[model samples]
Target: MMEKAYAKINLILDIVGKRPDGYHELKSLMIPIDFYDELYFEPSDQVELISNVDIHNNAILKTVQLIKDTYHIQRGVKITLNKRIPLGAGLAGGSADISATIRGLNRLWGLNLPNRALTQLANALGSDTLFCLYNQRAVIYGRGDQISILPPGKPIQNITLVCPNIPVLTKDVFGVFEKAVAHDFEIVYNTYLVTKKESLLYNDLLEPAFKVSPKLKDIYNHLVSLGLKPHLSGSGSTCFLFDLTEDQKNLLKNIDDVTIIDTQEHQ
Candidate 1:
């Protein structure tokens, strides 16, 4: 069986509060993009993970183990990952991979688990994994486990994603943000009612992301100097510009240490 794990971008991310368990409460509008990583699975006696990227602390491994232990399934599977999405770019690549694995294995093993059961299992993997299972635009809240699916809004066309070479850890970004200020939840539910073009877009982690890697601010400024309105995707490193002209796309192609991804093609 083959599954595609699509990447995602946070259109608007805001910190609501902190939970007693030390997890931060979050409210955000998240959408899946065309960019994806592919996972191939086949039945085997022993579970195995094959990938070019580093497998240490890999979410896929954890997901497989969790499934086996949770269900008491002795069957094993061989999984191969064809990695296209860049790692550590705040694009939820790892989360997507785990979600895909859960969904794929459920079918492969004939588990026939209900969506609610799958969602519950996904939540145990990571904050963003449950959202990935839906693979559509939605409002995510309560540490990203509670999801409310939205009707398809105005499509965000011609998006150009620029992923910087620098690596930014999500935990590091959140650590800096927590120390800087206390964020109060705004009436952001209204923002989701508008079209993608008309919605007020923002990321609360932007300032702290800059603190984590000052070079990201430099990249943002450079893109602005080119007469482009670029916003950080989620946490850091990857910035996206919407409705770019062909000339602008060509110009951005010349920049070093950057990858240009078009979301329209994926749509």
Candidate 2:
């Protein structure tokens, strides 16, 4: 089976608190965008993973191993990952790949596992992995394992993501954030309850991300100068501009060191 792993953008991300285990508690509104990476799976005598990028420590390989060990299945599968999502852009590219693998293997191996079972495995792999399994807009909380799917509000259309070539590691961003001032969750929660307006979208990690990558601020400022409202997606180097006019789109097309992707939800 072939599966497409869709990238996601965070509409709003607020850090609630830190846990005793050192993981940060978070509340985020995330939507799966149209950009994707493709994975192909075929039955094999032994597990094999192929990718242009490094595979030895790839999330997809880790997921494959986890499934075999947990299920005690001797069956192996060959996986081909054609990656499109940029790494370390806070796009959840790796998480999406693992989600796709788990979903595809469930059917290819005829495991017949329930969604809850798959979600359990996904949560173990990564916090964002569970959300990727659903491939829908959701408000995620508690280290990203807890998810509440949002009712279909308005479909997000005409989103343009400007991913600077620089990659910002999630851990690094959080590390800086630990020392930085945090946002008020009460305010964030109330805002989310009231509306999904693009103007209200915010990310608490932006300040720390700017600290980690100074150039990110320049990009943010540049977008603002162009009369565009750009917000960081997750702990990101990728900033999103929503509802861009045709002229603004043309202006972005001329910019350098940035990759642009249009938003499309997975069918």
Candidate 3:
């Protein structure tokens, strides 16, 4: 079985507060993009993974073990991961892969588990994993596990994703993050629904991410100096902009040691 794990961007991310569990309460509008990683699964006696890049502290294996223990299935899986999404780009690549594993293993093992059951498994991983399981536009709340899947809004177009070589760990950013006054997400939410534009889009993590990696701040400044309005995806080193002109695209090509992906919101 093969699964495609899609990448995502946060159109609106607001950190509401820190919880007693050391997790932050947040509200966000997240959407998937065309960028993805591919995973192919086959039956095996022991769980195994082969990826183009070496993975340390892999969540894929953890997910495999969870499934085996929960279902008491003796069979194992060999997963071949074709990684495309850059790690630590605020793209939730890791969580997406974990969610993909859940879906792939369900079919591979013939568990016939419903979405709710799959969601239960995903919840153990993280809130991002839960969103990736559905891979749709939603208003994510409460540490990201509470999802309000929205009706298909206006499709986002002309997306240019700039992924820097720098990897900004989410934890590190959040460690330095200070809670900010919450935005009324309803306004941002309703405005996007009506206008199909992100004129009011914002990400609270940008400040902390910049603090975590000053070099990333430099990149953001450079993009801004080029007359581009770039938005940070999550706890990001990667930044994205919409509707770039050919000249603007050419200007972006001059940046060193960055991957530029031309994509759009996945419909």
- Winning candidate number (TM-score): 3
User: Worst 10-residue stretch by lDDT in candidate 1?
Assistant: 179-188
What stretches of model 1 exceed 4 Å from their correct place? 178-189, 195-199, 265-267
lDDT of 1 by residue, 100-162 (tens): 999889988999999989999999999999889879888899999999888776667777899
Question: What are the per-residue Cα lDDT tens digits for candidate 3 across 1-267?
Answer: 899999999989999879999899999999999899999999998889999987798899999999999999999899999999998899999999999999999999999998788989999998799889989988899998889898876778899999998889999999999866567888887787788675788999999999999989998999999999999999998899999999999999999878899999887
Report the C-alpha lDDT of model 2 over 1-267, residue by residue, as the tens digit: 899998998888888768998999998888898898999999999999888777447988889889999999899999999988989998999899999999989989999999889989999999899889988888899999999987656667788889998889999999988534566655764576567566767788999999899888888888999988998999998998878888898898877888987775544
- Model 1 RMSD, rounded to 1 decimal: 2.1
Q: Model 2 misses residue 93 by how many Å?
A: 0.3
The models' CA-based lDDT, in order, is: 0.84, 0.86, 0.91
* For model 3, the run of ten residues with the poorest summed lDDT: 190-199
